[model samples]
Target: MARTNDDVAAMLEEYADLLAITGGPDFKIRVYQKAARSIGAHVTDIAGYDTTELRQIPNVGESIARKVAGYLRSGTVPQLEELRGRIPAGVRALTRIPALGPKRAMALHQRLGVDSPESLEAAIHAGALHGLPGFGEKTEENLLHGIALLRDAGERVHLGVAMPLAEDIVTALRAVEGCHRCGYAGSLRRMKDTIGDIDIVATSNRPKVLMSAFVALSQVTEVILHGDTKTSVRTGQGLQVDLRVVPPDAWGAAMQYFTGAKAHNIRTREIAVHRKLKLSEYGLFDAVTDELIVSKTEEEVYQRLGLPWIPPTLREDIGEIEAALAGELPDLVTEEDVRGDLHTHTELTDGHASLEEMVAAAAERGYAYYGVTDHGPKLYMQQMTLDKALAQRERVRELDGTSGLRLLHGVELNIDPDGDVDWPPDVLAGFDVCVASVHSHFDLPQDRTTRRLVRAAEHPCVNIIGHPSARLIGRRPPIDADWDEVFQACARSGTALEINAFPDRLDLAAELIRRARRYGVKFAVDSDSHAVGHLANLRYGIGTAQRGWLTADDVINTWPLDRLTAFLRKKQAAGVSRP
Candidate 1:
């Protein structure tokens, strides 16, 4: 019974959240919350230590250490269990809404008997919140929007969270003696932004051994189903995973069937039917003879149906079947096509890593060039001033080409409500590149918001529009805009739209990217990285680009260094002298 830092942290946070809902003393509650954070963030395992040793962690006193020992011993203490008995779990779940706090969650429960997200939504729609203090008509609207956000995120985990776990499991299982092939499938294999569940497919004769190994995985919190062919388990993060063991001969067919977007699979089955054949998870077979045709590879199956093998990303049945029939499938972009990251940060702003460290890391990635686009002065709390910006520029000049990477000094200028940027022409012209983004004013009416974005894109000094939609996946809905005008402005002004790669804000979402492409607008698949490690998020961004049907030619970052810099020079080429 070993516990990772996240495991301990989650338990502590849950206890603190429940405590707040139960109206515990403020000081005591604060003490437990602080201790929980300390234990969760500690570099070493808290379980291996005695109570006295545990006290070495910040904020953990004798009492807190005893609680930690209790948690490690049986996963909970008697005190926490007693509190859990008094509070319904749904009440705790209510606090997950963005603006809803523990106090309000409790208020809803006691005042209106709303204890869950579903009940809370019902209350909002029924206008039950109107007369309550601090709850207005606007509040009601926002709550409804919040519920939709929750629903959009329903039952699915972020690909960032699920992919690593699946990769780990697949790697381990592939090493087992009986396994012939192993990999994750479903929407995860399709590279969807959010995944419903993880599916692992393994081809083996000894299904019993595979099931035993899967159930015995250390990350498993609960085992729901266990059998020879299929086994299901729940992880500590509440993600469900299923492992299916099939015969070695059925490996290719199982991979294709399970890796499916249902509509795409339906199209394949339809083709099979027309060809006087049968297609199933087990294999493909002849209709009349009932004989196996092709089940050894996806390519073989697709070839038998008169088409080339389609990339998993394009298997969403969105014009892909027709394109395959015409032999016009796009050669989608890949991580190797990207030359460098354009939107990154350093310690001068909100970034955790410094210029030198970030530079060395970029060099390690073998980037042809890299851009340091720290927050401009408008962000305020980052304390960026003209002096600081210039000093960093001097450093960039010093480090340029020192490590096989040509560095560019840049700024992520904030676009204000009126669509104005942080600096005047000369100041902006000082940087090698500029990326503008909307940081606030998310609730503007459609026409006004559209005008705001168009103005930003048409700025003479702005080289790129960063995270155009400003949506935080499941947390914030995309702002309403007449997007055709936005893309047209980008095309006219030579301002590339960003495919920001931060896990939470994979901005310029796939649907919009496709539309923008139709406008002949180019894109930069930037990591939008704040730390060196954040650069690896490029894979997710590439996934999004492929989903949008983007090719290497559609992305400006895939160009050679000279071509990319020429694209960045649109500011100077605009011939508009700023006042």
Candidate 2:
């Protein structure tokens, strides 16, 4: 079995958690956690290297390298297995609940024997939690709420969580001796906002070796099935991944069959039937003689059907087939089309990096411009006072010339309950760009929420509405709002809505973006990055935008620097003021 970088990382993370619960040395636990972070963030496969090479990776010391080597050589680490034996798996799962750290989880396990979510819920309802230290009525209530949220978020994982795991597994599969090609398919490949499970397809001569290696991955906590052609496993993160190996002759057909929404595949099969051909996971065959036709590439399959190859993102049976037949498929926005990131943060508020560092990171990515839109004074723990804002602006101005990147000094002003910004007009006018956002009152009535957004959009100083829907995937639903009304106001007022690139908040979802496009609403795909590493989230935003059928022209950040600057200036010049 070939281990991926994520496998090593997950093992280390689990080791750290179990060690912590078992009262292991704090320094040792920290070392494992740090090593896990380094491995998880490494661009390439750390598991492919020997112990000496592994030690060269940042935060991976001699001890961690030896453990990693041991895990790769054998299926399990002795220390991790020992710790797992001491702590029940259910207790470890408790730590994943909100507000339940390892220490608290241990307390629950030792004091009340509450190990799982169900047991914890039972304890809370039975009033068994009240007498425990640090567990009051309020704490119990919060725990119950968290449990409900967890239950509601069952089975599905966010794109951010699932994507890396899938990529790691795919990388591992590709490393096999006889593997020709391997890639993820299904919803993850489609770049859906949330994914249920991951599906991977590969072409390989040695199906038994490929399947065996896949099921033996370090991340595989449980193997559901193992066969010559197919293997399925559940990872440590509770994501089920299935890998299928096919002959080179059936590569395209296998990919098309597995990378499907059931409806889309049904439609395609229906088309095949109409053409007097048979399409299956094996290959396309002639109806009369059953002769195998082309099956090496997706384009070949589509060509055989007399249709242009549709992008995987648009294969949702959402009029994409008709559009392809008519030669009208949208030239969707790609990551390369983006010129800048309009919504970003800095140390002045909640961001991890300084303004100069953030700007340098953006410039490194070949961005023409980067906005410094740290939070304004309204957001708790992330408040930027007027003095701090002014000082930050001055700093930005000083670095603007020497930084070799165009820096737009800006602020992310909070939209209050009344749909009004916290800052006065003069304060708002001082910045080159202002992103208005709602950080509170997510439960407002739909009409009130719509009015609030409309009011924010109508403000002349506002250039973009940040994370307009404010949905945290798998955690919280989008705030109730009449999106059509809000879109109308934004289109009329020239305020671009943001496709927030944050993995957890791919706001202004694809479906909504598609509908808003009808009203001529412009969009900005922003990273809303708090740290330099988070800037990579821009790809997820671009994927979401593409899923919405957005074009380069539809996203303002894709415009040239001069054009974008001119648009912002025009919006500022409109002279509309807050009521």
Which one is best on lDDT? Answer: 2
Q: At residue 485, give the lDDT of candidate 1.
A: 88
Instruction: Give the per-residue lDDT of model 2 (tens digit) for 355-434.
Output: 87888899889887888999988886775689988999889898885646788998898998889887888788899999
Model 1 whole-model lDDT (C-alpha atoms): 0.85
Instruction: Please estimate how well model 2 matches the true structure, expressed as its whole-model Cα lDDT.
Output: 0.86
TM-score of candidate 2 to 2 decimals: 0.73
Deviation in Å, model 1, residue 337 alpha carbon: 0.5
The residue pairs that clash in candidate 1, if any, are none
TM-score for each model = 0.73, 0.73
The residue pairs found clashing in candidate 2 are: none
lDDT of 1 by residue, 171-232 (tens): 88888888888999888888888887899999999888888889888889878679889998
